[model samples]
Target: MWHSLVRADNLFGPRHALTAVHQQLDVLQGLLEDSRGEYRHEVLRLSAQYAESAAWLHEDSMDMASAETWTSRAMEWAMEAGDEAMLPWTLFRRSQLAAGKRNAGQTIGLAQAVQRHERALTRPMKAAAIQQEAQGLVLDGDESACHRKMDEVHEYAASVDSSGDARSGHGDFCTPSYIEIQRANCWLNLDRPDRAVDTFQTALAELPDVYQRDRGFAQARLAIAYVGIREYEQAAAEAAAVLDMARGSGSGRTLQEAVTAGNALAAESNVPAVRDLLDAVKESAGF
Candidate 1:
C-alpha cells in the first residue's frame, strides 16, 4: 500500500500515502502493545522506520507538534533496537525541522547532541550533524561559524570512502547525494547564492532519479538563489520547474517554500517574471 501510494503520480496519491503510513503505524503500535513474548527485533526496527516516516510527513505538513512526537518515538524505538545509525539520523531530521522553524538555538542544540553521541554515528551521520550545525549557524547569522561547520562537513565527507556500510541509517539517510543537497541548502540560507547554485548543480550531477521530491526541493532552492542574484530569467525557469514538480506531489513544505520565494519576489515590480510568479501564487490557494 505504501509503495502504491508513493508511486502514484498525483497529489491525491501522496495525501493517501501519508494517511496510509499513519494508519499502518497505528496498527504497529497496537501490535507492539499486545505482544506477549519477547519483543521482535524486526518489529522494533519497523517501528523506528515508521516513526521516522511519520516525523517526515508531519514536517512536510508543517505540523511541528506531530513532527516532534514522531521524532521522539523514532528515537525511542531506535534506541530499543540498538540501532545507532537511526538515532543520529532521526535527530538530524529534527534539526532540519527546527531550522525550518527558524529556531536556530534548537537546531544547534540538536546537532551538538548528535555530535556528542558521535561514537555511535557513521561518517554520513557526522556529515549530517555538520550540515545541520552549518544551517543553524547560518540562521543565527554566524557566518564564520557556518563556514567552519561547512569545512567540517567537507573534512568528514573526505574521510569516508564509497565502500562503507550501505545501511548507515534508515531510509535514504546514508546517501552522499542527500548530504550534498543539504549542504546546498545551507549555502542558500547563508545568502551565498553562487555557492548554492554550484553546490546544487554538483548534487544534481550525482543524484539518482528516484527522489523527485528532493530534486524538486533543490530546484526550488535554486530558484531562490537565482532570485538572490537578480537572475530573473533563470529564477523564473526554476520556479516553473518547481511548480511542475509540485503539481501533484502533495508536499506542503515544497509548496510553502515556493510561496515564500514568490512573495519575496513581489517587491520587484519591474521584473515581469517576478510579477508572473506572484500572480500565479495569488491565483492558487491551499498551498
Candidate 2:
C-alpha cells in the first residue's frame, strides 16, 4: 500500500501525494485512538513515512512552513519507530527544501549530516545526498566544490549500477539517470544552459517509466534551457508538452514551470506556436 502511494507520487507529483499522506495520517490517528498493540510499531513507522512524504510534497509546492512542520513530525516518528534508516533521509528532505530556497548553507549542512551517518545509508541514498551537496555548491557559487562533489556522485552512481538490488524502498530517487538530472540542474544554476540541455536530454533518455513527475521536471527544465539559448520554437514546444503533462497529473509545480517558460518565450517571439503556448500556460496557471 505504501509503495503504491510512492508510485503514485512519482507519477503524479505533489498534490496527489499530499492526498495520499492525509489518508495515512487519518488511518494513523484512528489506530492510535484504538490503541492496538499488535500494530503499535507499524503505526509509528507508517507515521514517519507519511510525515516525510508530506514534507516533500509541501516542499515541492513551495510551502516551506508546512514542509518544516511535516519534516519535524517525520523525525519524531522515525525516532519513536526506532527507524534509523529514516534519519538521513529526513535530513535529505530538509536539504531539498533549503535548496529550493537557495539557502546553500542550510542545504550543505543538512547533506553533511547525512554523510556523517554514511555507513547506515544504502548506496542510492548516499548518491542522492552527495548530489544534493553539489546542488548546494552550485547555489553557493562554489564551482570547484560543486565539480568535486559531482565526481564523488559519479562514483556512487557506479556503485548503484553495479549492485543488482532494487532501489531501497526507502524511496530515495537516486537512479544513475537521476544523478545526471541533478548535474543538469547544477549546470542550470551555473548559467550554463547549453550544458544543462545536454545533460537533461541524457537523463530523460533513461529515466524510469514510473518517474513521470521526474520526467516532467526534466522536460520543463529543458524548455528553460532552450529559452536560455534563444531557441524560442523549441522552448515553446517543450513548454507545451509540459502543460499537457501538468494538466494530466494536476501538478502545480509543473504548471508553474511551464507557465514561466511560456511567458518568457511569448515575450521573445511572436510566432503562432509561442502565442498558443502562452495561452495554454495562462489558462493552466490561471494567470
Candidate 3:
C-alpha cells in the first residue's frame, strides 16, 4: 500500500496520496502498540518500511530534515529488529541523503561504515558498498579513489551469478539498473559528461517503461552533465523531457535537480535556451 501510494504520488501530482500514507502510518503505529512480543518484530519491520517510504517522499520534496528524521527512524527500527544486514543498507541510504545535501564528510563516514559492516555481506551487498564508497569519494573530490572504487564495483557486480537468489542486504532492490544509475551518477560527479551521457543512454535502452520516474531521474543527471559541458541546447532538451515526465510525479529530488541545472544555466546569463529552461523550472517548482 505504501509503495502504491508512493508510485501514485510520484506519477501523478496528487498531494492526497501523501496524506493517505500518513494516515496508514498512524494506524500501523496503533496496531504495533497493541501487538504482542513476537509480532512486535514484524511491526517494527513494517514501521521501517513506512519510514523508508516517507524518507523517499520527503527527499523528493527537498525536505531534508523530514527525510533525515524518517530515514533515522527506519534505521532505528531495523536495528531493533536485530537485522545486521539492514543496518548497513539503512546507513547507505543515510549516506546518500547526506551526499544529496553536499555534506561530503557525513557521506564518507556513513559510506565507510557500510564497507566496514560488509564482512558478512553477500556479493550484491559488497557491490552496493563499493558503489556507496565511490559516491562518497566523488563528493569528497577524491578522483582516483572514486574511479578505483567504481572499478571494484563493476568487478564485484560482474562476479555475481544470477542463478540463485542473490543473497544480500537489499534483495531485489539491488537490481542491475540500480548499479547502472549509480555508475552514471559517479561519471557525472567526476565531470565526465560524455561518459555520463553514454551510461544513461545505455541504461535507458534496456529500462522498462514502468520505471518512468527512474528514467526521468537519469535524464536529469544527464542534463546536468550537458550543462556542465556548456551544451545548453542538449541540456534544455533533456531538462524539458524530464519536466514533462515529472509533471504529476511529486518527485522533489528530480525537480530539485532540474531546478539546480536550470539555476546554473541561468547564471551563465548568455544562453537563451537556458533562460527558457529556467522559466520552465520556475513553473514546475511552483515557487
Candidate 4:
C-alpha cells in the first residue's frame, strides 16, 4: 500500500491521491482504536504510512499546518511501531517541508539533524539527507559546499541497491535517475542551467516509465533550464512535453513549473510553439 500510495502521488498528484488515503485511513484508524492484540503493532505501522502520505500531500497542497499535524502523528505511530525505522524518514519529511518554504537555514538545520541520527538511518535515508543538505547549501548560495555535498550524494548512491527502502521518500525516488535529476537540480539552483539542461535530459531519458509522474517533473525542470539559456525553441518543446504529461497526471508541481516557464517565455520573442505551450499551461492551471 505504501508503494502504491507513493506511486499515486507521482501519477495522480497530491490533491487527487490525498482523497484516497484519507478514506482508507479513516477505516484503518477506527480498527486500530479497537485492536490491541498481535495485530496492534501492524496497524500502527500501516497507520504511520497513511499519516506520512497525508502529511506529504498536505504539504504539496500548501497546507503547512495540516502537513505538520500529520507528520507529528506519523512520528507518534512510528514510535509505537517500535522498529524506529520511520524516525529518520519523518525528520526527512520535515526537512523537505523546510526546503519547500525556501528557508535555507531551517532546511540545512533539519537535514543536519537527520544526519545526527546517523546510526538509525538506512542507506537510502542517508543518501536523501546528504542530497537535501546539498539543496540547502545551494539555497545558501554556497556553490562549493553544495557541490561537495553532491559528491557525498554520489558516494552513497553507489551503495544504494535494488531495495524497497530506496523508494520510500516522497521526492527521493532512490533510483539512479533520481540521483541524476538531483544533480541537475543542483546545477539549476547554482544558476548553471546550461549544465542542468543536459543532466535533466539524461535523467528524463533514464527515468523508469513506471514513475510516470516523475518524468513529467523532470521535463518541466528541463524546460526551465532551456528558458534560462534563452533557448526558446527547446524550452517551448520541453514545456509542451510537460503539459502533455500534466494533462494525464494532474500534477500540481508540474503545472507550477510549467506556469513559471510559460511566464518566462512570455517576456521574450514569441513562436507558435511558445504560444501553444503558454496556452496549454494556462489550461492546466485549473488542475
Candidate 5:
C-alpha cells in the first residue's frame, strides 16, 4: 500500500494521490478501531505514514491549511504510537512546511528540533534535517552558514549505502543528486544563478528518471537560471518543456516555478519565442 502511494505520487497529480491516501486512511481507521495491543499500535503507525503522505501532497499542491492539518494529525498519531523515529521525522516535515511559508526562524527552529533526536534518526534523516536548516539559512541570507550546513548534510548523506535506504523508508530521497539540486536552489536564492546553471545541469543529469516531479522542478529552476543570464531563447525552451510537464503531472509546485520563469521572461516579450512562451503560460494559468 505504501509503495503504491509512492508510485502514485510520482506518476500522478496531487488530486489523485490525495484521493488514494484518504481511502487508505479510511481503511486504517476501521482496522485501528477494531484491533488492540501490538496490532493496534502497528495500525496506528501505518495511519501516521498515510497522514504524512497526505500532508506532503497538500503541501506540494500549495494547500497550506490542509497540509498543516494533516501534518499535525500525523504528529499526534506518531506520538500516540510511541514511534520515536516518526516523531522526529514529523518535525522535519513541519520544517519543510515552514520553509514553504518562507519563515526562516520557524523553519530553522523546527529543523533543530529534528536534530535533537539524533539518536532516533537515521543518517539520511539527519542529512534531510540539516539540509532543510540550510534552506532556512538561505532565507536569512547567511551564505557562509548555509554552505557549512550543506557540508554537514553531505557528510551524513555520504554514510548512507548506495541503495539510499529506499526500503528502510527513512530519507530515501536524500541521495547525492537530491542534495546537490537543493544546493543549486540555494544558489538561485543567493542571486548566483550563474553558478546555479552548471550545478543544476550536472545534478539533473544524474537524477533518476523515476523522479518526474523532481526533474520538472529542476528544469523549471534551470529556466530561471537562463533568464537570469539574459538567455531568453534557452529560458523559453526550458519553460516550454516545464509547462508540458506541469500540465501532465498537475504539480502545483512545478507549475509555480514554471510560471515564475514565464514572468521573468516577460521583459523580453519583444522576442518571438518569449512572446509565444508567455502566451502559453497565460493560457495554462488562466490569468
Candidate 6:
C-alpha cells in the first residue's frame, strides 16, 4: 500500500495521490490504536510515515493548512514511537513547509533542528537538512553563506552509499541530480536566471523518469527562468508544456508555477505565444 502511494504520487501527482494517502492514514490510525509493545512501535512508525505522506500531498496540492496539520501529527507519532530517524525527518519536512510559506527564519530554525539530531540522520538526511537551511539563507540574502552550505551539501551527498543505507526509502531523492536542481532553484532565487537556466537544463536531463511530478515542477521553474531573461518564446513553450502536465496530473504546484510564468510575461503580451500561454494559464487558474 505504501509503495502504491509512492507510485501514485510519482505518476498521478498530488491531487490523485492524496486520496490514497488519506485512505492509508485511516488504516494506520486504526492499527495504531490497537497496537502494543514492539508492534505498537512499528505501527507508530508506519503512522508517522503515512501522516508525512499526507502532509506532502497537501503541500503539493497547495493546501498549506492541511499540510501543517498532518506534519504536526507525523511529528507526534514519530516522537511517540521514539523513532530517531523519522523524528528528525519530520523536522526537515516542517522546514520544507516553512520554505513554501517564505518564512526564512522558521525554515532555517527547523532545518537546524533537523541537523542538531546528527546521530539520528542518514547522510542523505543530513544533506537534505543542510541544503534546506542553505535555501533559507538564500531567502535571508546571505549569498556567500548559502554557497558555503551548498558546498557542504554536495560533500555529504557524494558520500551517500547509493546501494546501501542511503537507499532507505526516505530522503533517497537527495542525489547529485536533485542537488543540482535545487541549486538551480537557489540560483533563480538569487536573481541569476542565466545560471539557473543552464543548471536546470543539465539537471533535468539527468533526472530519473520515476520523478515525473518533480520534472513537471522543474520545467515550470525553467519557464520562469526563461521569463526572467526576457526569452518570451522559450518561456511560452516551457509554460505550455507545464500546463499540459498540470492538466493531466492536477498538480497545483506546476499549475501555480505556470501562472507565475504567465504573470511574468505580462510585458510580452503582444507576442502570440505569450498571449496563448496566458490564456491557458488564466483558464487553468479557474479550475
- The candidate 4 region of ten consecutive residues with least summed lDDT is 157-166
Best by lDDT: 6
- Cα lDDT for residue 209, model 4? 60
Worst 10 residues of 5 by lDDT: 158-167
Question: What TM-score, to 2 decimals, does candidate 1 have?
Answer: 0.81
lDDT by residue for model 1 (33-86), tens:
866434655677778877887777767666779888999999898888777777
Clash-forming residue pairs, model 6 = none
Q: Residue-wise lDDT of candidate 3 within 108-219, one digit each (tens)?
A: 8887888788665666776777777778888888988887877777555632233222222353333466577777888888788888888877877755444556677878
- Report lDDT per candidate: 0.71, 0.80, 0.72, 0.78, 0.85, 0.86
State model 3's lDDT.
0.72
The residue-by-residue lDDT of candidate 5 on 185-223, one tens digit each, is: 999999999989989999898876656677888899999
Q: In order, what is each prediction's RMSD in angstroms?
A: 4.1, 2.8, 4.0, 2.8, 2.1, 2.3
Candidate 2: tens digits of C-alpha lDDT, residues 1-287:
66667777787777676787788888886786766654776788788888887887776675779889999988887877778788788998889888888899999999989988867787777887899899998999998899899878766663333222233545356777888888888888899999999999988998877778888978998899989998888888898987877776666667777777887786765788888887787677552
- TM per prediction: 0.81, 0.90, 0.82, 0.88, 0.93, 0.94
Return the candidate ranking by lDDT, descending: 6, 5, 2, 4, 3, 1
Question: What does candidate 4's lDDT look like per residue over 152-245, in tens digits?
Answer: 7765553323333225443346566787888899899888999999999877876766666667778888889999998998898988877766
Deviation of model 5 at 258, angstroms = 0.2
**Pick by TM-score: 1 or 5, better one:** 5
Residue 245 of model 2 has an lDDT of 76
